[model samples]
Target: MSCWKYWPEIEEIAETLEGLGAENIDHIDELNKIDIEEVKKQLDRIEVIAHDKDIDFDSAKHILDNERMNKALKLIRKFYLYIGARLETENAQEIIDSDLDPDEILNKFHFYERYEGLLENESKLAKFNENKTFVFIGSGPLPLTLIMFRKKFGCKCIGIEIQPEVAELSRKIIDKLGLSDGIEIIVGDETTIEDLDYDILMVAAFAEPKERVFANVWERVTPKTPVLVRTYSGMRAILYAPLTDKQLRGFHKEIMLLPIGNTNNTSVLLRKIE
Candidate 1:
């Protein structure tokens, strides 16, 4: 959907994916029709350019700064999130149903492998035992991260979601899962991070305007507080926009762990610069 009219070279491609979206296309629909393979081919190319081992971060910025590719990535990102949202909402509802086995429904999720890696590696990435009140921004409608954190780590979590309806839905899911005591979903946004006294702060991959959010966090949080920002790179950036190191100027990046799975998020552990 980028530069269909302005750029003749990209016009044919943009016009092809003109209707790429969730309302028109279900997540379960075969992506082959959307030329996903072609899109992936381009992403693989970008992955090579951005992560050639010797290339500096500028390689990635080159892709992000490119107006044509960036626009297409953004459009595809929205479509991807829409599909994921629908699936998660459906799964949440299924868990809420008294007749359905929540375990059965959860077992169908493709993220078990990913979350298990997180469960095993979180301690190595960040300190969670010192204090357990963790606040997660952009927790979404299902709050799966909070659920997993509470269940696995015995930690308490507060989810701050910008959308009121989505936060309410997440609240329902937590209650239905009988985890109300360990997790709470509130209707708020990035700004909410400042008002809460949390042992740790986590920014989800979907949180918008990464630089602004991190700046706000830097200005508001106490000195030396732990911050974990979930980021994506390489082909993963086709879905979630990758964060540039420049965006995190006020934080000391302590440790980074890239998990291998569908969740393939790079967990960047940060501490506020004193």
Candidate 2:
């Protein structure tokens, strides 16, 4: 019996890998056909198969490492972001309605504390100082990064949100927290950075078309300015696409920070080559 007959889930993932490698068509269409929850289930199965000594680990590893599988995984991550953006919109309201302190809510998410420590360590290595201006791309509805940066470092921060509803809600949250003076939430995209001045640039984890954003930043921002990119590697690859080796070639300085908690997500500090 063939693997497809015995292991349908594995075959489904294999088929997705083949499909991604065969075309350069609309990724959204391909993404629409996939169920994020289902994909996670398939990935979980693959992980188990890869570790099972009785199973063919080498064969499973080959399929997992296939170039096409990586591409398909990236598309799945895009789908995840698409779904997450909508969820975040609802979550923002939930946070607002809960009557909990915004700081307490942010701390519950662990990002505020994670970034606080990450930035502190980065400051020592990169000679970073407080009070610098920060512009966050794809700041989403919560703008946790902006709030954290301003609260922790006393930095001036601006958040660019492409979705009008998310931008409005994020502003409301910022205002409620009385951070309106320190953090500005603008309704815009990556292009918004072109007209603004900032000492540091932060790329959100869900930001798409990252290559284009990087190119735009290189063309518009000063070479001395540092860009902090939140990306996934290792097991987190299921949720986010990690920056590839080729992507790191453009930056003059690149430092990969330590992972936070159990999440496979990490930050990369980059500076444009002069």
Candidate 3:
């Protein structure tokens, strides 16, 4: 089951969050005061809710909709990811300084197993091993998805991160992982779409202003190049951005893969007929 922390205390959390708080959670000082174990516990609790036989999807969704619990849930996830990125950067730098193998640290990452599960589901729908070039937006400091794609399929992976410092850190960790040759990280935002040439484009769930990013890619990406948007819905929409049918109305082909609770985002693939 999916367990999100503080699922029961959503009202208090929501009150703590200011306006449009999810977008600015990374810089929230009060959130930083939250103990790491507390964050982990909350996430664990959230995951378990998804698997509770007594709670159907609709019931869980209703809970989130009550008192705008969804906002608090999303704030927790954004905070979780931001803290995770910072922790990864610190630990990775230590490993690099020691000149030790980066494998152990990478393999033990918080979302390592979750990412593996996501890729398994993705490969079932997309051509990951057929020399496909993947461009992942909002790779953050770890760029774990791009790294996994390169190592698992031996395919070329390009990560476009909006934060320059995060992109620089991603490059450092990737180089330590000995994947610098296979993965490339560039610093730019949604407008970077015009500069990339890839067979597959994947947008990260955490990428902000999701609508504008989708629109930018739609306008500039090559027709028929499959654009896979990572989204969430139902109760899981609390953990990530939700995608609507309205956002994907004009695609010639549309496919959505539901997560089995081990992961967060639902992969939505859209292709233009050209």
Candidate 4:
């Protein structure tokens, strides 16, 4: 939460961990929640600010009890602390080897990325067909690509997001833009590979790297499913299903890169045949 109250503890912990010569770190994801060291670092700073301002537990508790001033201080700080504690730990190095929840981090990241702020009206939606079911591998800035596809092809879209926040945002954006009926956003990984019969699968390459881990996650289809993948720069060499092929493609003749606050030279669109 607020670095004002938790900074000292976090720093102490980080320093202690540092002294212990713990270098490697791992992520924690439970119930679509991410436990990250960065958030813990921020909490440590917040604790520092709290001490500098002479604010203590009682003061924070008081402010939190009030409704009016809660937004500026209490609410933000409290949630920050809650999230920080959930995602991070003092002795992460010792547990780094344990199973980490990648999906939790992905879902949270997805939720934030999708609905952090208002998207301009100029942003386009990906193309899809309602009559067909499609799997959206990644929900990045180019989610519009999927939206457009849904509108044109009548496809039912199952969008998988890495971050819970981004997934929430995507849901909000879909609801706000009146696209909810067509797209079903799921905040997690696709596990049932063999059972999925998606007519097509779409993904944003740059958004979800290290995709090799989930390479065969897609389920088996009858003959082949059309997978249209988009990449910002020149496409990296990635093998697809047997009958798939790559081609330079774009929607609305433009694609947005939200993180960089710009657009791309061209979106590398791939069409997977089998």
In order, how many clashes per candidate?
A: 0, 0, 17, 54
177-255: candidate 1 lDDT, tens digit per residue: 7889889888877888767878888888878788888888888887667788888764455556778879888788788
Best by lDDT: 3
Q: How well does each candidate superpose onto the true structure, as a TM-score? A: 0.75, 0.70, 0.82, 0.38
Q: Tell me each candidate's RMSD, in Å, in order.
A: 6.3, 6.6, 4.1, 17.0
Best by TM-score: 3
- Put down candidate 2 lDDT per residue, 1-274, tens digits, no spaces: 1122224554566456445432422464554455545544554554443334343424443434667566555555544455455445545676677787865665565234555665654454333236578888999987877876687678788999888988999988888788999999888878899888788887787776777777776776667788888776444444566676565556765687755443335777888776
Among all windows of ten consecutive residues in candidate 1, which has the lowest summed lDDT?
1-10
> Which rank order by lDDT, best down to worst?
3, 1, 2, 4
Arranged by TM-score, best first: 3, 1, 2, 4
Clashing pairs in 2: none
RMSD in angstroms, candidate 4? Answer: 17.0
Candidates 3 and 4 compared by lDDT, better number = 3
- The sequence of per-residue lDDT tens digits that candidate 3 reaches over residues 151-251 is 88988999998888878888888888888888999999878968777888888877877667767777877666877777776666655547665665555
Candidate 2 wrongly placed segments (more than 4 Å): 1-64, 67-79, 98-100, 110-130
How does residue 125 of candidate 2 score in lDDT? 34
User: What are the Cα lDDT values of the candidates?
Assistant: 0.68, 0.64, 0.71, 0.42
**Candidate 3 or 1, higher lDDT:** 3
